[model samples]
Target: MTLFRHFRLLPRLVVAIVLLVMGVQPLAAQQPLTRDTSFTVASALRKARKDNPTITLAQPAFPSTIQAQRNLTYCTVGGRPLQLDIFYPKAKRSRGYPAVLLIHGGGWSSGDRSHHAPMAQQLAAKGYVTVTVEYRLSPEARYPAAVTDLKAAVRWLRTQAGTYPIDTTRIAVWGFSAGGQMSALLGTTNGDAQLEGSACQTSRSSHVQAIIDVDGTLAFIHPESGEGDDSRGLSAATRWFGASKTDQPALWHQAGALNHVTAQTPPILFLNSSVDRMHAGRDDMIKKLDAFGIYHETHVFPKAPHTFPLFNPWFDLTLEHTVAFLAKVFPKRP
Candidate 1:
């Protein structure tokens, strides 16, 4: 009976020996695949949908005079179809316009580009070519993938400059929360060879003229003591880096926007909610920028949540402020 059992296990042992000799490792020796955070984000979307029943997945109603295009398909990020909605002023306007690229935030895991369609259309109506882009989410795609896709989108727009009536020299990036982090990174690390190589190799310029970071995490270095605990929680860093605070310190810092700041960074506009839990490190980023004498403006909205710019009253005010700020920075062509 013992001999019979040994004979039965001989084939398995032979296969293991063959794998070992071929340098093929078992799945157990490899790192487990990361779980997608999109499920949780999808749940939040469902809640938002329920809470705001009137918020249909429809294009913003722009005036007929303005040429608004919806669901203009863009490239796929990691095999997933990504897209952007473009709003352009009519050609008869007799002047080219600056462009604004708006990125939506849902913790880097979820949020459609269309979330900012209304705002984009509003900007377009104000004579700017507005593009809201879609990027890859976490777990499915990891750190730098989102940033790569964003830079790709920028390069794509630059290629279409003449066709879209965009002022390639004056392009600016704007985002809320996680999107803000990406925009800030895009502004600061414009010339980074690693992040900008794959997608933007043909592009000579990576300089975004300005940035608007709304209640976003600017620094990856967390406070020594804070109201929100990093214990078992989801954040942009965790989602992108795929490691806990204790597990991967080096990667966390590498992925941080603060670590990449340089004097060449474009002028920045930072809008924050006074009551937001993540406000501490953003001040550190401002201090770093100030140390470098980089141009910047900041606004703190009292008694508001993290992404207060998305809600009404505050939303209207933010748009107004953004328009005024952009006008001051990138004036319309005469």
Candidate 2:
């Protein structure tokens, strides 16, 4: 009886040993949760608004403190023009202004650059040159296409440093939802050949100095991740990855920001909502960051919706943290 009981641990040990010898790191532990698409920004916002009728989207449009430039062609992919909108502070800094690129969230399928316009406008007024860029969604493009488009956007933003007030060295990426995941990836995958989208044609680097991930999952298949459920037979992540997690485990793993973390990863700030699933892989990623001495910060809104940044009180808090983080990470120029 004792010998048989001891052998119960053998199977687990054998698996770990085999993985180590094969140079394979196992996936992050899986978290059990019922999948629900109601966590989306739109659905969450509706309920949140019903509870507080006074809640409104952040910032008024066409603010006088900032000068706006729209529809600037950033990249041309096979004759399809990709555009980005830039927000510049009316009062220029002689030493060049630190810049931030804002990416919007839409489950990699349905979102536009304008989704982050309010964020860009407000950030620009705070003396940071801000840009909101458009990327190919899954409806038309696939996994790497979105990645490549964002990288190209970064490159384009860099190339404009000479033409604009941007300080090339002090650039950051801030994103919401799916955009948030991409934002983390941008920070971790800096200089990775596979992720460096080549459509921009510029030799300038697509590096970001910091990352702001607003309720984005760090890993798609982790114990904390809410992705790959397919309960409805077609989850959003599936559309983005072009297949089910079971069918393309490696590709799903590739898109995970947690898998790419290194000592070189830039400082990151996470602003999360009430959804536990959206907090996916964040703690584990932070552990890795700590191990490498990388700077990071996190804050969770007790009951705020996933799209809280789009509304007032939560938006105000988000802006406060964002500005402070940027100020700390990017030293004042002039």
Worst 10 residues of 1 by lDDT: 51-60
lDDT of 2 by residue, 10-78 (tens): 787665566667776544323433333334445656787876777776765666888988999999988
Any runs in candidate 1 off by more than 4 Å, and if so which? 1-61, 77-79, 91-95, 224-230, 233-236
* Total clashes for model 1: 0
Candidates in order, TM-scores: namely: 0.77, 0.85
Q: Name the regions of candidate 2 deviating beyond 4 angstroms.
A: 1-44, 50-54
Question: How many clashes show up per model?
Answer: 0, 3
Clash pairs (backbone) in predicted model 1: none
* C-alpha lDDT score of every prediction, in listed order: 0.73, 0.85
TM-score: model 2 vs. ground truth: 0.85
Per-residue error at 286 for model 1, in Å? 2.2
* Residue 77 C-alpha lDDT in model 1: 46
Angstrom error of the Cα, residue 88, model 1: value is: 1.2
